[model samples]
Target: MTKTAKLYRMVMDKHVCPYGIKSKWLLEREGYEVEDHHLTTREQTDAFKGEHGVETTPQTFIDGRRIGGYTALRAHFGRREADEGGTSYTPVIAVFAVGAALAIALSLFAFGAPFTVRTAEWFVAFSMAMLAMLKLQDVEQFSTMFVGYDQLGRRWVPYAYAYPFLEATAAVLMAGRLLPWLSIPIALVIGTIGAVSVFYAVYIQKREIKCACVGGSGNVPLGFVSLTENLAMIGMGIWMLLRPTL
Candidate 1:
């Protein structure tokens, strides 16, 4: 049985356009049947507004699915198909990278002079970068990937807290240089989470939802770049793990 290409209607007027022609260009590339219903009259604009609140041209409909606004439309198509899965190397590589990043991060605090604000600040910056990257890469999926917990609901409550709590801990340890051994477990936990996120983002593209790792409005969509970054962190962590002593 041949599956029909889903019909997507986009009504765009010149005045209240979103992304201008850029939105249309992207929609066309995504195989949408785009028709620019340019509304020149107040009556036309009003009628269009009545049908869909906010008379914005470039309003997208995917087989009757009203994906309003340019941002929403981008999100809809940018989402990967649920059935797709990640590459074989994604998880293994990511784990190694995260592990290594943690190890190096921990060492920074330990090796640096104690009670120095400079060292503390450096560790803070490094930790911030790592957390930003993880959030960008959608680290929230780690719980489901490694622990088999429900991505939704309190059954997977621990993963919810792990993202920030552990990140802060990693940074703290790196700054205080306290119990470098503690870093090993923390690294392991972060690596496990990162590995899972890479796996799902690559393979189960659509099923994986965005991780608002950073609290902000305009989130970057999760993709392979994120996976590779997480993988690098894993490698850094592994290097640290093998070091003779913390």
Candidate 2:
């Protein structure tokens, strides 16, 4: 027996309800033959909402039972939304994902190959630059979080504020292959300090804190993953230094 569902969704001249499309897709995916109803005008949509006593639309009916909006439909299908707040790596993941894509695109344009040795270099450079941009978004807020765990950041508050700019400068220089002498040292120094700070604070001292690497939000938990970010910079610096010899 084929199950059937009815969906009431907003379809307007200038705008279409995104959730309505999603609701229809979900119903079909669940093996329900959906009778999709389009409320083509604002007045029609409003009247439908009023009749159903719903604040929003893409309302679904499964066997005469109201299944609510897209979120509600998702719940009915046992789906969970991505964890967003408190402590999560979503922001870091998002930044790096975009960074990696940009790295590939840049590499493809310059080297005509997505997997060139320069691609790896670009990945690190771009990721670092993007991360620095996040910190630069709110220097004051980032410095406040950074002070709690960073050794140099604790000693001099101003250093914490200057750190993001330094990071970004190094990253940009590395990306452009500009002034290896200056950029390499900056990368090495900042990376070494960051790695040592993370090691002592999280591993030795066993302090639980947010990673300032992401941004002002302080949602990403300070841990080995954060340590890897610093390690990557140090590794990149060393690799670049050795590249001229080999």
Candidate 3:
């Protein structure tokens, strides 16, 4: 005999709960025969909640035992649960991966070669530009979060707000191969500040803070990833300065 499950979900005129849909899908996918019950009316939902002593909809039951909600169902099946405010490197990794690929593609198309020193320069510039775009999404939020660890940002609140624009400006100048005198200094200063901030926060202070590298909304930890990003910018600035002499 096949296993069976019961799902009690909300299906109101204004809103059909998304978790309810997910629960039903998960049950069916797991080869369980699901008997779905929709509490369409507000009164019905209220009564069901009161009787079950549960506050939320999308309740599941297996073999006459309550299986809780969507998260619970996932846990029952031994699936990894989504982290609640936990640190992850996924956002940074995705940004760098996409940025590198774009830089390589653009260099190959424009210069007819992807292995030149220009390719490395383009990669750093593109990555900085991309990162600046993320920070610019919500400058206020990013600056607020950034002040926690960045010494310069903490001392001068305005610097946090201006950092993204500065980074973007440097990136654009470098990418366009224009105004090297201004771009090199801007990249070097900001990158140096960022590197020191990351190192102090992660190593010296041993504080566990969220990185503002990606954005205010990211959950990336303040660690090696943040340091590496700053180091790459610093290296790019030095390379640009010395390229003319070499």
Among the numbered candidates, top TM-score falls to 3
Error of 1 at 211 (Å): 4.0
lDDT of 1 by residue, 1-246 (tens): 321223223334545444635667677787666755555666776777787776565566655567775666667778533333332333334544554565455556667534443433343335445554454354455433323322332355666546555655655564444566775466556655665665665477654443343322223334554454445445434545675233
Model 3 quality (TM-score): 0.84
TM-score between model 1 and native: 0.37
User: Scored by Cα lDDT, where does model 3 land?
Assistant: 0.90
In the order shown, the candidates' Cα RMSDs to the true structure are 12.2, 3.5, 2.9
Clashing pairs in 3: none
Go through the candidates in order and give the clash count of each.
25, 0, 0
User: Per-residue lDDT tens digits of candidate 2, residues 1-246?
Assistant: 999999999888899999999889998999999898999999998898888888898899998999899999999999886665668887789888988999899889987999888888889999999999999999999999999999998998888999999999999999877888988999999999999999999999999988999888758889876798899889988988998432
Per-model TM-score versus the true fold: 0.37, 0.77, 0.84
Question: Candidate 3's residue-wise lDDT over 21-140, tens digit each?
Answer: 999999999999999999999999999999999999889999989989999999998889979778777777777888788888887998898766777777788888988999999999
* Residue 69, model 2, lDDT: 93
